[model samples]
Target: MDNLALIESFGDFKDEKGISKIDLMAIIEDSLKTLLRKRYDSDDHFDVIVNPDKGDFQIFLNKMIVEDEMSEDDDLEIELSEAKKIDESFEVGEEYTQEILVSQLGRRSVLTLKQILSTKLQEYNNAALYDEFHDKIGEIVVGEVHHIRNKHVILLDDEGNEFILPKENQIPSDYFKKGESIRSIVESVDFHGSKPQIILSRTSPVFLEKLLELEIPEIQDGTIILKKVVRIPGEKAKIAVDAYDDRIDPVGACVGVKGSRIHGVVRELKNENIDVIQWSKNPEIMVKRALGNVTVNKIEINEETKYALVYTPVEEISRVIGKQGQNIRLATWLSGYEIDVYREKREDDDVNIDEFRDEIEDWVIDEFKKVGLLTARSIVDKDTDVLAKLVDLEDETIDDVKQILKAELDI
Candidate 1:
């Protein structure tokens, strides 16, 4: 191939499947640069020279000028006679270029080059993917539902690239229709081989926050700050917001006049229920607000461990915990605290509790207190055998505690 043909081949470096030539050349250059960098530990010192005339690619490695060809193993050293071959006026201490053919590479050398190229290209693609989605992390991207696999909804972007929306990432009430356009946040971007894979989500609390930011001008303008969000996907979400500007009510701004702003967001989210509450710095208040629609009688918070003991009416326990403990789980995640629910002991239930009066109550209570279990409610919730092991109690004492707990707590 002539020089022009060789350069044109690089320019037309497309695969038979119609991949871009420039992209292929970039992949090749990236591959070569990685290999040379690792082998020489200097990426900038090597120049890749592609000669179309000789159908060869040469790596012009610049070595330091050395005096006297004393080291026989130095391939960089050129004897005065050998130096004269390329240039008759060649000096003893000058760097030179040696032409090498790609075709002359052995099987092992070829394999090494292939591996280096593949690895570098993958790394480059991953970095590119991260850069592409990092700026768009809070923004929504529209995609078409393509197919379903292993309970995950596969979606296609505008470029026809496929992305996996895992089952856990999808909103509960939102059913995806084939070829239907769905909106979601670019939760994350990962690189696999030569392409980028985007992770999409609708159930993330961040999705609701982003939607509010999109709909509410006050939030986008920094007058209102979204502090925390606890969500049960399509079922319900509780958002805690604060007002940076005293004149603006954060909750009022999110609700909009006649509830327009939040309604728009709710509509987009398939009419998922939302409760906007004023954010409080107090851990007790924050935990109470996180358990939305549930009336909390009292809350005791431990600042050191970030745990809360919450007491609620017996009827509200299921509502606070939600189906499959989703509400409590989301509340804990959003509030950054562990919450244990308890109901107050009733006076009428004391008759049943009196049956186990004499059996090891003081010993179990002392052991429980030593191990940080300060409440009778916390002790009654534990499994008798595990609690016995934790407190180093005899099996007979554990059995007595279990009966007492079963009678008192109705467990």
Candidate 2:
């Protein structure tokens, strides 16, 4: 069983691939046992063992020594007279071990074992790759852009692992060039085929969180805490942060001097707007702050519905809504509420428009306010037919609703 060369050869090969000796030996021994049973007798009992120092293995057959000198089956049954030549102490009808050599194992069996070991090594390497990167999900990695496909960029990470940066995960404003550096968060890891699949992203909210952790030393050291972050990807994001120490301003820290700290993140995001909001336990205050520069005169909330009605000045409406509602969209995501920003308006007759919130449909309420019909008196005093046409309601529908308002107003 002195197979030092065989073991040394495998050891050298596996060492280069970072495979452990125990794992390789298990694969080799298992393959040999399968080969031995397949090519030999199905009833054969055997055990395989490898000498660690010599790097050699032996296949020993457990067979009985019978006194039947006429028995022709030497593979499983050995005659006592013949067995005595090898061992003088051998007894009749007793089981003994026979060491089979590699030559006796046959060329076909050895070749099959080689193929099995090769396949097992590939599987081992794939599993090793998976184990190495599975914990890196959500962490940032620096990579060099190796190649760009139709919808993905192949990046070689710092550890020399190839990660897939799909177009969907990347910001729309980002462009890829070969040999350029790429920084992104690890979104996922999978051993799809021969290699581990690492998916990277630059647009995920987690990426923004990582960037904040990177740019702000206080956040990393825990002086400042990021309560929550939500992004609309390439357009805008809202991040709620708070300072544990009153002396330290979390919002100011994140914004940096002259917009320096935030500028790093903004440049990385292709100039995407990031509103570092002062996190508040009160949902009303948080919702108002999430609107960024928009000044909120008042905030009304329905806790059960998680809906916020924000009243800002008429000039601040566009800022609250942002371009194409992106600001409001991200604000809603960050504040955990459905926010509807409104401008405060009073009827010329000093009518209370807030009372009509329940009377008219939510959509038509804005049109009525826009037309200066800010009160029940305004709606009821106006011609009901003309109101139906103006608000796109049927005459009966308008009359039925307005009658209730008229009776309440005692008109």
Number of the top lDDT candidate:
2
Evaluated at residue 202, the lDDT of candidate 1 is: 90
| Cα lDDT of model 1 by residue, 256-321, tens digit | 888877998888888887888888888888888888868899999888998999998755666777
Q: Which residue pairs collide, candidate 1?
A: none
Sequence-dependent TM-score of model 2: 0.77
lDDT of every model, 2 decimals: 0.70, 0.80
Q: Which digits, one per residue and each the tens of the lDDT, describe model 2 over residues 1-411?
A: 234444565676687787766777777787677677677746257888865555567778888788866666777888888888888999987888888776666777667666766777777878888887788889999999999998999999666778899999999898888999989999989867677898999989999999999999999999999999998878888899999898988999999999999899999999888888899999988888888876889999999999999987654665777776788898898889999866564443323444444455666667667777777677887788789767766787678767866654555
List TM-score per model, in order. Answer: 0.60, 0.77
Candidate whose TM-score is highest: 2
